[model samples]
Every structure is written in structure tokens, then in C-alpha cells.
Target: MPFELEVCIDNIESLSTAIAAGATRIELCSSLALGGLTPSFGFMQQAAKQSTVPIYAMIRPRQGDFLFSPQEFDLMLADINAAQEAGLSGIVIGALTASGEIDTKNCRNLIKAALGMGVTFHRAFDLCKEPTTALEEIINLGCERILTSGLAPTAEAGSEVLKQLNELAKGRISLMAGAGVNQSNVKGIIQQSGITEVHLSGKGFRNSLMTFNSSNAKMGADEVDDSQIPVTQHQAVANVKAVLDSLS
Candidate 1:
């Protein structure tokens, strides 16, 4: 198979744009501002109804960190069940120990709960203290793929480690390079990291004019309250197309 491009979409508008742009797959989530939390069941159902491409729903309950409390893990389990029922093709999730290692038991339980559905370990792998060790453990636990920035802030900085991971993975699991990937650098990241699959969020933000009334505004108060303005952006098809074109 040729290299695979997975687009991350934050909303329905972006989902449509990505599909139109020729994306073969999508990872659906809410609140990209928070690095993606689980989308609602209704949203997942709507996306599945409208999208021809496979949609993988993010299963994270909150942001901030990858370490999940027992209740949060349970919530994730329920989310996975809901996603399965709503017709998602797969799920993206990750968990880590307080000491910064893969939470194998929780991961294994999640994998089992998925019950033949596709599972991609999310960028939480980058937060692990030992990525190579975590990669090995996830592979052993039967994850289908791992979305990573190679334990670095961006794929470019982590290219060498990602290359090592790609070689070591050896078809056992997929190493998908993401984070700060764009048309300009995707080709280099792929070439250097030796990864065939890549993930990108072709997103652009737009400021909303709508705002809440603030009675507390004073003469000296700042004219614009940053919190009152909502920013909206979605995965664009053109962004995905550009990356594909660069790879080709």
C-alpha cells in the first residue's frame, strides 16, 4: 500500500473539507484547543453518516495530561463503547503512569474493550519517559498504530529517534509521525523517519464576532476581551491535498 495520510478534524465543517480534499482517513475530536477530547456520540454518528472515509474518534475525556484516574479510565471505556455503537472505524487513545511510562494494564484493558476495532495510541507516547520501551510495550499489547512526535516537540527535532523507531517497529506496528507537520516539512520527516503513515491537522482559525455582554467594561478596560471571542477552525481538504502532493 502507498503512504497513508490521516487528517484530524475538530468539527463537521472540517470533516467535510477533509473528505473533499481526498483524505482516506480521519480522527474526529472536539476542542482542538485542548489537544482534542472525545467528541460527542451525536457528533460521531453524524460524521459516520456523512463521511465515506474511515473515522477514528478520539477517546480522551479531558486534556492537560495522559495519566487517567480510575474514573476517567472508566469514562474512556464507556466512550469506546459509544464510539463502537455509533459506527466509528476506530479509536485514538493513550494512557501513562504517574512515573511517565506506558500504563500497560490500562492499555491492555482498553485494547480488549475495543474488541477487534482499530486502536491507535495517541501522542501520549511522546510524553512517556522512555518512548522505545513504551513502543515495545504497546506493540506487545497489540496496538495497531502509534501517533508520535518522536518524544520531541516536533517531528523534525525527533526525526532520528523516529527513524530508529520505524526500523525497530519492523511491520509489527505503525509509527505515525505528527505534530508540526506541513507540506514544507512532511517529505523530509517521512524520508528521514522512514515512516509511511503520517497525521496532520490542516486547520486554520477564524475569529468570531459574537461575544457576551460585559457590564464590567470600564473606560480604561481593554476594548477586546480575548475570552469573549470564539475561534473556529477545521481540517481543510486543501491541507491534506498539499501534504499528499508533496509526498507524491
Candidate 2:
């Protein structure tokens, strides 16, 4: 089987780059620096129009913890509706209980909202109290795949646990290793973890086009730096895709 390369993108430029570079899937989001918030409805619609491969809209409601209030859950359901209306092929979603287990009830509701579209449990899996228990819960929740880093900071760092998780999954669902994945370490991650699918941003920094400078003024949060924009590089994605194709 051909290995799947899912590119996580936060902007139209990166979206076009990933597609042009041979990405098999796209995870649409915004503010990837904050770990990816839900993309705007317009963004989703534009991505659906541009992507030939499947596009999965990230359904995260906010930037903080996965534990969400009832209102937040309602917002997620609305986002799912927007994804469907936008003609997206899938949705990436995850929610956790206060105690760190998968929020099965809310997750089921989200899954039900997604209905005909594909569903992937996002990296919130890494935040669970127990990896093994979380795996079973995710499989039971009916997600088509789980985007995880084996409960570690990066896929390369967690290859061993990823291998264990892959073995335990037994084809019940796909385990797509993500987090800090790049062209350099992607091959090793696939070999060590035995995962057929991988996720990455393939991002590289570029200075903004604006010639004017405002050193004292800022448009975002205190920590935000608008000088350099993070955009997915065609060469970066193509490099990883080449590796996957070679293994195929």
C-alpha cells in the first residue's frame, strides 16, 4: 500500500504548497503556532475548492486544554456543520474528560455530527493519563485514525511507544505519527514505529513582504512575531513524499 502523507496547513499559501508538493491529505487549521485552532469557514471552503485530495478541518475550539465546557462543545458541533457545508472530506477532533480519559460522550456526539465524513482523533491523545487506555477508547469512539506522537514530545523521541501502539492497534485503526516531523527524521520515524501514515507541517520561515516596520507596534498577542511567517515549503513536503514513495 502507498504510505499516506497528511500535511497540516494553516494558510492558503501553505495549502497550495502542500498540494503542489504531493501531499495525500490536508488538515486545515488556523494559528498552528497555538497548536492549530479551527480554520475560518471561508478558509475551509477555499481549501475544499483547491484540494484534490481529501481535506480534514481541525475542529479545535480554542488554544488551551482539551477539557471543554458545554458551550465550547456546542461550538465544535457548529464547526462540524460548517465543515460539512464547506464540502470537506473529513474532520479532526478530540476532547478529554477532566481526569484525562477520552471524552467519549462528547466525542460520540461529534462523530455523529460528522456522519458521512471521515474522523481523526487529534493529538489530544498525547495528553491522556494513560496511552494504552486512551487507544482503546479512541478505537471504541469510531475514529478512522489517531494523530499522535506516542505520548512523547516528538515522533522520533517516542518511536518505541509508537511501535507498541501500532502493534496493539492491529489494523483496527491507523496510527499517524506526528509532532516535530520533518524530511530529515520522517523515514526513521516510519521504520521505527511501523506506521503507514505520517503527519507534518513541512514548514519553513520567510520574512514578511511588508517593507514598512513598526518595532514598537504589534497587532497580536505579546508573544506574537509577525515579521517572519511560517509557510509550508514544497521542497520539504516533496522530500518526505519521496522517502515514502521509495519505501512503497
Over the full model, what C-alpha lDDT does candidate 1 score relative to the true structure? 0.84
Q: Per-residue lDDT of 1-248 in model 1, one digit per residue for the tens? A: 37788888877867777777767789999877678999999999999999999999999999899889999999999999999999999999899999999999998898789888899999999999987888899999888899998988998888899999988899899999888887678778988988888887777655545465456654333664444422223334455456666666
Error of 1 at 55 (Å): 0.7
lDDT of 2: 0.93
- Scored against the true structure, residue 214 in model 2 reaches a CA lDDT of 83
| Model 2: residue 59 alpha-carbon error in angstroms | 0.4
Per residue, candidate 2 scores C-alpha lDDT tens digits across 1-248 of 58999999999989889988989999999989899999999999998998889999999999999999999999999999999999999999999999999999999999999987999999999999988999998999888999999999999999899999999999999999999888789889989999999999988888999999889888888887889888999999999999899889
The TM-score of predicted model 1 comes to 0.88
Instruction: For model 2, name the residue pairs that clash.
Output: none
State TM-scores per candidate.
0.88, 0.96
Off by over 4 Å in 2: none
lDDT scores in order? 0.84, 0.93
Q: After superposition, how far is residue 133 of candidate 2 from its true place, in Å?
A: 1.8
Scored by lDDT, the top model is 2
